[model samples]
Target: MVEEAARRDLAAIAITDHDVVGGIAEAQQAGQRFGVEVVPGIELTAEWDGRLAHILGYFIDPAHPELVVGLERAREQMAAHVRDVLDAARALGVEIDEAALARYRGRYVSGATLVLGMLEQGILRGSPHARQLLLRASREPRPFSAAEAIALIHAAGGVASLAHPVKLRRSEPLLPARTFAPLVAAGLDGIEAWQIVQGPTVRDHYRRVAEALGLVATGGSDCHGPRSVGMRLGTQRVPAAVLSAMKQCWRDRRRALPDRTGSPR
Candidate 1:
C-alpha cells in the first residue's frame, strides 16, 4: 500500500486494516523508505442499533493495551465463527481440506480465505455461492458497539470516523441523519464523505451531513490490495487538508483528556 501510494504520487495514506493493527508498523517503515506518510489506523467492526457498522481509527497507538486485548478477543471470536461455518459445511456433506485451512489457524481467518479454500477443492462453484455462504456465516454478534469502538479509539489517542456510510446498508442508498446522531454523540470525530463507491451528489450529501454534525469530512479509496478489482490506491483524491483537520482534531481530543496527575494532557 505504501509503495502504491508513492507510485501514485500520494503524499500520505492510511493503513486501516479490519479488526487489527498488526500491519501498521510495517506500513509505517515502508512509508519512510518510500517517502510517503503513513497514518496508523484500524477499521473496527462494531454494532449500531442491531446493524453492523465499521469504525475507522486514525493515528492510533498500535501497542495500546486495551486496543490490543480487545482486538485479540475479536480475532478469537472470528476464529470460532469460522469453525462453526466449517462445521455447517461438513454437515451439508461438503468436503473441506483441513490441511489447507490449518495454515490460517493462528492468523486472522477471513471469509475470502475460506472461499478460496473451498474453491481450491472444487466445493464452491463461484462468487454467488461464496457470497451467500459468507453473508450467512457472518450473522453472529459483533464484539463492540459503535460507542465502545469510539471509546477504544479515543483511549488509544486516535480519531474515530464512521466508514463508508453509503455502503453500510444495501437496502438503503444513504442512511438517514438520525442514524448518525447517536454515533456523533458518542464522539465520532469524522465521517467518510468521499468514497470510491459514491457519486458526486451522494458525496456532497454526506459532506453536508458531516458539516451539520460538526465532524470532519474524510475520504479514502477503500483499496484492499494491488490486485483488488475495481479498487485502486489513492483513487478518492482526498485533499491534504483532510489530514490536517484530522490531526488537529486528534490534538484537541488529547488536550481535553486529563493526565494521570489530573492535569489536562
Candidate 2:
C-alpha cells in the first residue's frame, strides 16, 4: 500500500488496525522506508444498545493506562472469541484448522488475520461471506462499552471517532455522520471525513454530515496487515492541522470534565 500511495503522491497515513496496536510498529518501519508519515492508531469495538460499535483511536500514547489496559482486556476476550468462532465453524460443517489461525495471530489484534486466512484459503470468499458465517454460527461477540472505549482513548491522550459504522452489520448508517447523533451528544470527538473506499458521493455525504453535526473530521488508511487490500499507506491525506483540531477538541473536553476516569457521558 505504501508503494501505491507513493505513486499516488500521498503524504501520510494512519495505521488504524482493529482492537490492537501491534501493527503500528511495523507500519512505522515501512512508512519510514517509503517516505510516508505513519500515524499510530487502533480501532476498538465497544458495545452500545446491545450492538457492537467500532471506534477509531488516533495519535494515542501507547503506554498510557487507559488505552493499554483496555486493549489488553480486549485482546484476551477476542482470543477466546476466536476459539469460539472456530468451534462454531465446525458446527456449521466448515473445519477451520488451528494451524491456519495461528498464522494470523499475535501480530495484529482484531483476529483480522483469521478472517483474511479464511478468505485466502477459500474457507470464506469475501468479507460479506465471513460476516454471514460469523452470524450464522451465532458468533459469540465480546464486550467493551462505547463509553469505556472512548474514555480509554481519551485517557490515553488520544482522540476517538466512530469507524466505518455502516460495515458493522447491525449498526445503522455505517458511514458515520448520520450515525453519530447520540455519540456526538456523548462527547464523540470526530468523524472519518474522507476515505479511499468511499466514492465521491459517500465522501460528500460524510463531509456534510461532519459539518452539520459539528464533529471534527479525520481519515486514515485502515491498514490490516502487510498486504492492505484496497488502500495503500498515506492514500488518505488528513492534514496535520486536522489532527491538531481533534486534539484541541480533546483538550477542551478534558478541561470541562473531572480528572477522574469513569463513564465519559
Task: List the global CA lDDT of all models.
Answer: 0.81, 0.66
Off by over 4 Å in 2: 1-8, 25-35, 89-94, 104-115, 122-140, 168-179, 226-231, 234-241, 250-265
* Candidate 2, poorest ten consecutive residues by summed lDDT: 256-265
Evaluate residue 210 in candidate 1 and report its C-alpha lDDT on the 0 to 100 scale. 88
Q: What tens digits encode model 2's per-residue C-alpha lDDT throughout 91-204?
A: 667777667555654463234555656666787654445676655434435457787777788777667887755455543443445556778776678877666666566666
TM-score of each: 0.88, 0.74
Identify the leading candidate in terms of TM-score.
1
TM-score of 1: 0.88
- CA lDDT for candidate 1: 0.81
Per-residue error (Å), model 2, residue 226 = 4.4
Q: Over all chains combined, what TM-score does candidate 2 have? A: 0.74
Task: In candidate 2, list every pair of residues with a backbone clash.
Answer: 1-232, 165-174, 166-174
- Residue 110 displacement (Å), model 1: 2.0
